[model samples]
Target: MTELAVMGPKESEFVDRMGLYYERLGGTRTMGRMYAWLMICDPPHQSLTELAGELGVSKTAISTVARQLESGGMIERVPAPGRQHHYRIVSGGWAQVLQVRLVEVRNLVETLDLGLAVLDDSLPEQRARLEETRDFFAFSNLDGMELLKRWEEHRKNQD
Candidate 1:
């Protein structure tokens, strides 16, 4: 296991890439970098101070970003009996991320359904496009749920 602070070129590259990837998905760059660091860091968990030092960010920033990650269900905080608070990636974190995205999909579908109700179905042009979009959203939600269920089975088998 490689300590994030001591990562060589290749591991550092991975952290950088993960940071960019998450940023592209609309997360703050700092939080994305911290999340990448936690995902592959040695010893599994790191205190906020440790993370701040490793990422060269402020402790306040680490605390804020760590709480954001926690709230999003991407990471878990480990409470030590007498030591500082620590953090690690949640098990199947990517799956949890996808599940969170599925909620957004549901929201969009509901909004589209309401729009469809208000639109005149007698006109083929406007209603057709909205109908197509609603269909796509519904399909995506269905497929996403099935994929998660399949992932759960795969994870269970591995365990």
Candidate 2:
């Protein structure tokens, strides 16, 4: 298997494109660039200066991206005694990110449930539509919860 540090041409192209896609999804281009760099860079935790140099960006840009990642729980800030703060991808980061997104999913499910209840007092035609919506969201919530449980188990195993 190829080492993580060495991205083949195809992988490099994919990573670059993914960075752009993430940018379109409300993340800054620099944040996406930093994530791509972290995925392929050697030694995991890169200094801001190193990432800035590698990505051909300024240190301030790298610093901002690092803070964004840190707050989003995608990366951790490591401050060793007398050393500058360094950033590393969080262990089981994807699972945690998914968990956070699931909160929104749960809220959606709850909103649907409320709609279903409101429709129960309406005409039969409206009730059918609302019930259908409720069923879908209920099933979705159960599935999301199952996936979350699995992720928790997987994270525990990794620990």
Candidate 3:
């Protein structure tokens, strides 16, 4: 009776769609379903056994996925009353995810810089293209970090 007992068709459909979206993000389909479910689950926190039953996945699957999500700063693990661990979505701006994005953008800029350094100066056309790429990545990293800062400010204002 503590469990959902039965998930509605619409809910299942939503989870399925979320799973697909997560798959596009380089994660397993079931992990996506688990995330979507956690976002809307009535009680907001659930034990591994509960999640396993709700997700129709093995406990090991839940553990693996939850650990991965946890490492990514997406989900959090907490202590349950029954000595088991509970899982829930980490609230707020997802600064860690944004940090990862910024790092990727920085790497892109670095790669572009390296290309500019190694490319032949005689090939004006190639040099120009690399310069353009370098400029774009540099701008992208700056813009992305600025946007993240604005987001933090917005969230702070809301608080």
Best of the candidates, TM-score:
1
User: Can you tell me which runs of candidate 3 are displaced by over 4 Å?
Assistant: 1-6
Sorted on lDDT, best first, the list reads: 1, 3, 2
TM-score, candidate number 1: 0.90
Q: Clash pairs of candidate 1?
A: none
lDDT of 3 at 94: 67
* Residues 3-44, model 1: lDDT tens digits: 445666786788778788878989877888888888778877
Q: How displaced is residue 28 in candidate 2, in Å?
A: 3.2
Candidate of highest lDDT:
1
Report the number of backbone clashes for model 3: 0
lDDT of 1 at 159: 80
Model 3, 25-57: lDDT tens digits are 888998899998998886788888888998899
Per-residue error for 118 in candidate 3, Å, reads 1.1
Q: All candidates' TM-scores?
A: 0.90, 0.74, 0.89
The TM-score ranking, best first, is 1, 3, 2
RMSD of 2: 4.5
* Tens-digit lDDT string for candidate 2 (1-159): 223355567756766786797789889877877887787677777778777776778999888889888888888877744456667787667667777777877787788777766664648888787778777767776787799798789878987
TM-score of 2: 0.74
What's the distance in Å from true for residue 48, model 2?
2.0
